[model samples]
Target: MFSRAVRPAVRAGSLAVSRTAPSNAANFATLREIEGRLKSIKNIEKITNTMKVIASTRLTRAQKAMEDSRSYGQTSNTVFENAETKAPEDKKTLLVVASSDKGLCGGIHSGLSKATRRILQEHPEADIVVLGEKAKAQLSRTHPNAIVLSFANVCKDIPNFNDAQAIADQIALLPNEYGSIKIIYNKFLNAQSYEAGTVEAYSEEAITQSPNLSAFETDEETLANLREYALANNLYWALAEGHACEISARRNAMEASITWGFGPEPD
Candidate 1:
């Protein structure tokens, strides 16, 4: 019943419809892929949420410790400032750098390492004292000849004053050949940022140059005792700061791992 012209028109219509079908199918496939990715992200959000909660809980204790030590550390430094005016002078410098033994804490290790490297580059002749295995390992590679002392496996649980004492003793006895001591560690500003600061141990020159010592009333014996106390307190503060940084780093790393579809579940 159909004419020959109608037959050719029907064939052309069928060909056009076939050409459009693949494109629509491809679009649908792409949509499905995107949906899968979104679901994965949601799963990650849940894990990160849990981790954030846990980190927040631990952060309270760490923050309290940090706050309590700040005053003690400052007072100790003031005492050192008073006594350093009489200490003997030398020419060599010793640098004490602290870091965490573990990784996966967002760039905590790398950041500390980078900062330490910059310090080393600035003072190429200084001797290095590294705390934590990670620091020892990294500095070993980047500065093979600089490291004079290293302490590893120091963070088992809560870092203690005893650990600080041990570290302080080592630093205090740096052959008495070194002119000055510099302690470098991450200063925790907040959850998201840290500053690497190098604090020089109070020295005779520092005391003479300081303009704020007139307020203190102390004699030589008391001044010497204060200097020793200040050194220990500084070491304690460094340990506490390092511990806080480790927690922050671990939390950040765990969250990142969750985001990247790692860990227990994958959506």
Candidate 2:
């Protein structure tokens, strides 16, 4: 219906558009892929930001509680430290390890595991009550027989008096009747620095038998109550502090993981 000259021009224009269509579709596909990845990165950024906020809030509250607990624990145990309470000879020992049940933090759980192994090497006969599954798994591999009790679903939040009390009650029910209880936890030195530490919760007998016990005021029935209370108090402090360490370590590790979103590492 048109002249030959115009027909040739129209056909050439149609061929050019046909040749470019695939490239346009390919470009759109590449753009969509890039967009999907960008969205993923953005989502991760949001998650990272949210976690940072949560960690900061938790860290603040944990620090406040830890300060109060630390003061209380120090004050409560000052007497025992002053008296130099020593466990009796040849009695069973209970190691109450304070660690979290989860992962994602750098060396936080492993540090406690290594420390626990070292302690086991030193006191091969001592029994242990692991507070978290992370430590339980590590210790179970080599020292399964030594693990008497293990509690999970711990360290998801800041520890309170009730948590400590419950753990202590279970420990008290154990038939071993340990001469002394030692709590090993990761001590939060700073945001980036942590190390394993131990706090002793002496038995009622040790408390009464302390060399300088007579120096304190007279109390017949209060010694048992004090022993129980101090055990809970120490556990509360250790759990709270160790929880803070985990949160701090997780926040730091998460922050570092952001770089991985860029791409694969260079060879």
Candidate 3:
């Protein structure tokens, strides 16, 4: 009787141990999965923080450049503004889209795209010259055939006169004799704001036909050089301001990310 009773107790204990073993193993596996998720979150936080720092570092330089370029661009447009040059509605138009290849900058590119679409609604015959892949992709969705030229690998850094000159040279080479050239870009309003803006480059005929052209004494050759120079200058200004806007937008996005706990808690 004692042996039988002892054998039953042993079996019961063995069964309990087997059941508890699985429970322990399951708990360990759950803990491992939790640890892995925490690790991934930490890694994401690190990357976000790094990008935030970089954006902050770039913001100052970009703003300063934006200001200087604004002055330069305004001065370049003085002649046209003074002359009251108007684009001829009868001729075809060219739109130069100033956007970049990189994306984490919120709606900077999309805003420009929307503005372009709105302008196209007004001038459906306008041909597109996209400066960045981001804008190209966005415009291609609705206006694929309108894209006359799409450039890549631009505005990755602060824009310079040389970049603008190269782009203007390419535009000048296009087969169409565009009546007007308009550059669409993001205008930086403040640290947390930006909007779509346009900078116009008048054609030689438009400049010559301006109602007030008689106020400035110049020849055809000089007018041609001025047109090229002004186009490049305006392009440089637009690109610089757009770059600043993008940096600011990126910084704001990072700030929002951190606020939403995508990064480490603020100190």
| Lowest-sum lDDT 10-residue window in model 1 | 81-90
Give the candidates in order of lDDT, highest first: 3, 2, 1
How far off is residue 220 in model 1, in Å?
A: 3.7
Residue 119 of model 1, lDDT score? 76
**lDDT of every model, 2 decimals:** 0.70, 0.83, 0.89
Supply candidate 3's per-residue lDDT for 86: 95
Candidate 3: where are CA atoms >4 Å away? Answer: 1-29, 262-267
**How far in Å is the alpha carbon of 19 misplaced in model 2?**
22
Count of backbone collisions in candidate 1: 1
Q: How many clashes in candidate 2? A: 0
1 or 2, which is superior by TM-score? 2
TM-score of each: 0.69, 0.82, 0.87
lDDT of 1 at 105: 61
The most accurate candidate by TM-score is: 3
lDDT of 1 by residue, 1-267 (tens): 669979999989999988776644643458889999889888877877787677767777777777766777777765555544433344667788877676656666666678888877867888888888877887788898889888888665556677777788777676645656677887888886787876666644445444656567766676556555666778778878777876776676666666675652221
* Tens digit of per-residue lDDT, candidate 2, span 1-267: 989879999999999988776544643358889999889889977786677677767787877777777876787779898888998877878898898776867788878888888887878889999999888888888889999999999977788889999999999899877888889998889887789999989898888899998888849689988899999999998998898888788777666666554321111
Clashes of each: 1, 0, 0
